[model samples]
Target chain A: MTTTQLSPTPRTTVTRGRSRAVLDRDALLAVLAEGLVAHLGLATPGGHPLVLPSAYAVDPSGPDAGGTLYVHGSVAAGWVRGAADATVCVTVTLLDGLVAGRSAFHHSMNYRSAVVIGTARVVDEAAEKERALGLIVDHMIPGRSATLRAHTRKELAATAVIAVPLEEASLKIRGGGPVDEPDDVEAGVWGGHVPLRLVAGDPVPDADAVTSGGPVPPDVVARARAL
Target chain B: MTTTQLSPTPRTTVTRGRSRAVLDRDALLAVLAEGLVAHLGLATPGGHPLVLPSAYAVDPSGPDAGGTLYVHGSVAAGWVRGAADATVCVTVTLLDGLVAGRSAFHHSMNYRSAVVIGTARVVDEAAEKERALGLIVDHMIPGRSATLRAHTRKELAATAVIAVPLEEASLKIRGGGPVDEPDDVEAGVWGGHVPLRLVAGDPVPDADAVTSGGPVPPDVVARARAL
Candidate 1:
């Protein structure tokens, strides 16, 4: 059942930085949506932990317990083979700023992160797989998927989409300036944060596109500005 | 022994995307140095995999097998306790651009990523731990450590520094514009890429810094510009 509050399982609860833990479901979704890539962690057959970055998408109305998070990979990837039906951890982090404290001990980063733990299942249903693929594309460039042609059958066959329920999850956010000790602050040490953001530069069209293709589409321009 | 080329172990070999694999150790180091946070993966005591983001620093002339990668955490953190002497994976990714292919299948991201797998050990040595903490601070803001006072005894006691050898590692890079299918190109579909970069905004000074502290240091400005 969908819940407005994040009901973190015992394993997902934040025990160390309890003050940074956010229990609002919308906060978790915001973190997932703003992030472009996710780090998927799982164990190989030999039991060694592995972490790999992959493009991901989230659907709040998805058919999982609370929602669904989709991460795609090449079907031939070794990690993809091990990810099917395996207990995995998905972590997405967006670095907001760099905290410059008066002392080294107080130096930290301003970031928003979401961690989801669940058993990942490979999507085999053709319809859901196709929709997930579209969502993934739109997640990167909104409205660009509709302008493109349909994926060929062979292309679909080579891709593997893994779905994980966003049921057991936690969100952590650390923002604002550095919290320096009173003595350090009184010492008049320069302290603050420099904001960091992912920004898009001018689009570089393919050589062939520049020669033959028409002007860059409005959707592409909008996507660049949105970033 | 220090080697210039990356000698990937069987587990670190790039079987799926061999063409994108980089064997140069310098490339791996470049990616690590550019990244601010790393996703650390390890199996918890219950055997469930966990992934968390942490600030990290790389020391090439370190005492580890090849080099050393350090990640610090609160000593009270549950994962920090579980990470000591355990097999772990650390992945650092810097997203470069978004590939807008003619079709959804060819859409991808241009990025430089480094993945290191090794056993992690807690830094118990007083000197090494203190040096690692300084490195972590300087890694985030170069030259800022020298400007600050030393860490207090109690502050150091609350921190746990984990070191992982940079021996088993692999680097993958994807750059340039979209590689669309010939058919899609023939259809006159506009395809290109938008470059993405982490940029720094103006420094937001702390309330006390604005009143009593001096101006933002040159090192802080250099760090912001470097990004």
Candidate 2:
């Protein structure tokens, strides 16, 4: 049962920055979908914390409760092995702009971020794992998966796909210009924000593709233009 | 004594993607300096791992065994309080491009990332804390702190700054086009990369600044153009 409102568990609640906390589940989904990279945090066997970047995809109708977030890594990676069946935190952040204030204390960054805390389990089933891998590839480049062939048995075996539920998640957004003190704002010091975005350059085909004399695929062109 | 090469401890070593591991200390510093936000991973009091995004700055000649990386947070934040004098992992990633391979299994992202694992301590000294805060502000906008007034004592009290040494850090970089199987590349499939970069848009002055009829500062304009 998907809910419209985000039900933040006790640990997921935003206690300090209550003003920036967003309770809407759609906001959480938006932030996750817009972000390309996710930081996975989990404890190592020695009890030390480890954080690694991974490509991820979200499936609203996934098998996991509250939907599923798929994160893939090499099966040989120690962090991937350690994350199996363990509670982990996934954070995706999109920096919007740089907030310049009249006072050093007020300098900040405009951003949208989502945090999810849940137990992650490795997907051992072949069918589910293949579907998750395809989702991840499509997440990066929409409609490109249909153009590619199926993954071989060896390739599928070499990857470890972990799924985490999106039940305990929270979103935070801070936008607009700097919020300076009244005195600072009146002091005539310059205060504003520099907008930032992730942009993509033209696609460069590889030697083989160039030699093959094939034009860039429509999906690849569309993805670059969309960015 | 700053070493020229990164001295990765057993845990910091990149065993899975050994080909991408960069050992030069300068490369590690470059990656850290280029990134504005860092994902900090640490175990909560309840032993569950948590990852939070924080603004960070790198100091090459600071009062730490291997220089220092300063990360600031609100004093009221639970994550900040939990990170004090605790082991933590900080990861900063800059996505360079999307690697489009001929096969689904070969799709990947080209990125440069640095991971630092160390014990973080909250800055207590007034002078050091103030300097760290200035660095953090300047890291976002060059010469920004000079235009702003000093931080008030009350404001300082409300902020918590944590410093982690640059020791035990490792960097990974994946560049160029996708590496696909011979069969896939020979099948006339398009393969290449779409370069991605964080760009800055025009500066938008605040209402007060617009009303004051003051031009955007040179530093702000230059920063935007540089991006």
Candidate 3:
């Protein structure tokens, strides 16, 4: 309660304590890029919110100006239809640390997260939409567009792509130690951080990966190492 | 779109060209429990949708009753306060497979997900609130509760807990190989399955873990392997 008045940009409600509100775009973008799952928030026609886990990427408008978030669903997805018309909200979070406390009630987590609030303009045009697809492909495998077969017109029709512009976004992130309430700290609970991580084991190439194939690609290895 | 009309349940959406939308309670529970993160959908005080990424669990009740979901947030969380009196929509999703294709347009993910629409009730009573916190603690670390200190009365008062009964929930699941749009199969795109996993490394106990400070505990090592 005292935090709301003392801390600037204080969230109206302090759900998850002071730890939930992440600040700024640089921190947000880092969280988004490092994380794997994304939450696509859209309004139902009846007015309730629909939040689904989705695979996404931060789109580059190349070397200038702002970026857009790229997300996709089946053309038949109600979420896409929901996204096509309304101002959709998107979020990506990575749980980086699990804070262990002396008491059950005092336990918490430290995480890096990105939350974006924007209207999704459905990419309907052919050329611009290709860019969205490229962002998504490169998101999973860098330099994949040049290596893979291009999309045909029919395949394009079934995929629905929505581009959420990178404006009006904020990241409320908290990382580091457990801010245990004073009384709870000396309660003699095993207190400290259990550092959580996203790690990669040896790559299992496709069963049919070419014998002709070169060494495990540097990009894939780099991405896995980064995780 | 035609799937909505054909579904035997309430408000079932189209499963798309390939049957990706599955409607089952068992499936929903699996998806919600498999992943550690949940995109908790709540309405912001501003009346727009706010999707926060948090941790959650599907808590099944005794023999005659069904399960409910437990999601935690800051006592003063802006969006959570919105859920206290209104219908709350909570969704949890796990991305398990990457359906790669020769064509960029055909890339997809193997996913299992759950969405629950329910009214959240505040855990007002002290005894019940304690149980809720227990669920959250065990949700993160299965057998660690008995090993930790219990919360003090003051710590309990500072937390807010809410439960959303999982009665009117829907689950949509998709898994398996790439549904190559008829033409791209021969395009020689390296495609099949790239499985995603959450693995644990050797346990690293707190620096001051034991009052006497010995080697890492066997219990921690066993838990890491289980994860």
Candidate 4:
């Protein structure tokens, strides 16, 4: 039920805007779990950075639940290969709403974000890699891995899974309505929080499945309904 | 109107998984403009990369339209100071849906993202900095800057604005239903896309304004209605 707290290292510390930084481990993990994708920053051989989008998941409960972040992609991905030993940065952000203020300068957003800094190690063991891949799949669609066919040897070989420890991670959150200046607040100008959320629309079954004539699984239907 | 296309240089080229790469300049700009925040990747003094979230704006149409990305924050921000002449990677991603496949390995996401590789230049001129600040404010809520009180000279001095050119940017997109393997498709399992979108809810007026009883601005009401 608990993970280690965020470290006080210079890289992980929230120096600029201290009020937004969250040090609690569980809160940080919750932010990570809420996001579906992470922006991974890797340093190229030439010393330039590449920030790319990739699906990622965090262990919900286990020894690695709060400490390890699992990310997988095609074996041919250049960033994945570079991340094996190179220092990397991963960020997951969920935008909740737009904070509207009386003054444009005070406008902001209600969001939750987590940033992890570490060197990613490749999961070479087949068993561990397979489980990591499953965590990722289920991360997107809960209970999905159990319903799908197991990953074959060929499929497993074509995938690359990397693990980054959350030793130097930090969570930042901004919530609630706008904090406009006192003068602006009394100026009779409108100010409020415009809530924004990710809503899922009805699913459109694939064309190829029409001929197959198979019933949609209960879990898939349930997931869509919850969204 | 079109700006220059993505460069064919080795670093900027789409070397791996070429199918997801998009070379159209306008397409890349559109993706950048869709997202409210951008994850900026910058290297630390010790050469480690850190990816952090910050508000951003793209000039929609003008001399700098589709070519310049503007990002601003407090002058006290370390990353903003480090990014003055350092190579920076700016990424803006918009998640559209969850692409569910019959097999775990084939599951994917529907997203549009743009990655820009360039060194951020500090905007030091007072006039240009002020103008850039307005551009950013209006980017989130159109026509907002004109109605608000002018930013104080002290506030302007305490802010730093960075500009990165989009000349070496590329857009990567994946949409529609999952492209499961032929065998999986014939396995008679359900597969489809769970469409996702950022929906805006009704605005809740600030508590302080409740007593003032000021009318909500038309632009604020219109923006919420459109969302």
Clashing pairs in 1: none
lDDT of 3 by residue, B1-227 (tens): 00111123233343443345454556666666666667777666565677877777557771113576777766765665678867667877666655555567766666666667767787777776777677777677666677766777776776777788777666666665555544444444455545555665554445454552344434445556766
TM-score of each: 0.97, 0.97, 0.84, 0.94
lDDT of 2 by residue, A86-202 (tens): 999999999999999889898899988888999998999999999999999999999999988999999999999999999988887889998889988777888999999999999
Shift in Å, residue B82, candidate 4:
0.8
Candidate 3 ranges beyond 4 A from true positions: A1-24, A62-65, A181-188, A201-227, B1-18, B21-24, B62-65, B202-220
Q: What is the TM-score (0 to 1) of candidate 3?
A: 0.84
Query: Which candidate would rank higher by lDDT, 3 or 4?
Result: 4
Model 4 Cα lDDT, one tens digit per residue, A1-227: 11223876878777666877656887987788778889999888889888988999886552353468888878887777788987889999888877778776777888888888887889888888888888898888889999888999999999999898877888878888888888887777778877888878887679987678366667677777876
Quote the true-contact fraction of every model: 0.88, 0.84, 0.43, 0.75
Instruction: Write down the lDDT of every candidate, Cα atoms only.
Output: 0.90, 0.88, 0.63, 0.80
* Better model by DockQ: candidate 2 vs candidate 3: 2
Error of 3 at B180 (Å): 1.8
Ranking by DockQ: 1, 2, 4, 3
Tens-place lDDT per residue, model 2, B58-176, is: 88998987789999999998888899999999999989999999998899999888889999999999999999999999999988888878889999999999999998788888899
Candidate 1's error at B138, in angstroms?
Answer: 0.4
Candidate achieving the largest DockQ: 1
Docking class of 4: medium
lDDT of 4 at B56: 85
lDDT, candidate 1, A1-227, per-residue tens = 01222777778878776777666888889889999989999998888899988999998888997899999999999999999999999999999999999999999999988899999999999998988999999999999989988889999999999999999998888899998899999989999999999999988999999988789888889889999
